[model samples]
Target: MENLNRSMKLSLEFGLSGAVLLPVIYEVYANISTSIGLFLVAAFACFAGVKFSALKFREAFVGITCTIAYSGILGWVCYLFIHPRVVDMLLKRSVYFSLDIRQQLYFLLYCFIILACIYLIWLVRFGLHKAMEKFKSNSEKTGSYIENAFDDGKDDENL
Candidate 1:
């Protein structure tokens, strides 16, 4: 169906975006400390959420979630395979840090927090949009009432 095709297209786009962006992001963060890099990535996730807001709510939610999953997978691949190979070739040494259990737990906690923040932003945007629509409708009704009142006064003057 058309909707299925559209959803697949969106998913592919998001996946490709993640595949391309995550490595570049890793390169950018390579020189930075890990904590700072994590924060920067979280900020990037928030920006992704904002960008995804352009789509219908359900579509945006699905797309963004897919994007995040793709990014995580790509990031893991880079960390485990590509990065080690590159570092070993260039530096003639292994440059990698295997996170302890606690570190991993912390990382997961941070990821969850980032995801929650992104959804919160989406919810706020949706709420604001609905509120604005309601406000516009109310204003139009008020305008109509004022116009009717003025027309009634005009009829009285004619009499």
Candidate 2:
């Protein structure tokens, strides 16, 4: 029952996002390339996230598959509505193409660095959880031993 509710909520959220993106995606994709390469890269990012979230193989694959389908469908819709004229104008006016390639590459490198920082945060969270688990296990063992020792001492006193 809890699983059903969670699934329903996720469905609603995704549906709402899709509906909202349908209209705004054109604006987002205007500067971004419409190439298959970009789409695949986005899909891969989603897949990596899904894999990280889902520990089991089946669950991970299911998430990746769903994400790929959603990404493609959403991207297609965004592409269809994108304002190409505005994008073309921006591209013509921008110094990106005229600027040093090294600078552009450095900018992309910084973007990846930011993403790596976010990944590090997740790693820290995972480490904290493992530490907590280890602490809890050790405490439980200590508790059991103390209880047994007390029981033995009580028996000796009573004797």
TM-score of each prediction: 0.69, 0.42
The per-residue C-alpha lDDT of model 2 at residue 16 equals 42
lDDT of each: 0.64, 0.45
lDDT of 1 by residue, 81-154 (tens): 55555555646654544456786666656655775566677677777878999999999999999888777667
Which portions of model 1 miss their true places by more than 4 Å? 1-14, 19-31, 85-98, 157-159
Q: Which is the leading candidate under lDDT?
A: 1
Query: What lDDT tens digits, residue by residue, belong to model 2 across residues 1-159?
Result: 454444344434443454334324333332344343234334434434433442333343343344334534654555455545445666788722222567445433433443233234434545666789899999999999988877766677887
- Model 2 residue runs over 4 Å out of place are 11-65, 83-135, 150-152
Clash pairs for candidate 1: none
By summed lDDT, the worst window of 10 consecutive residues in model 1 runs over 23-32
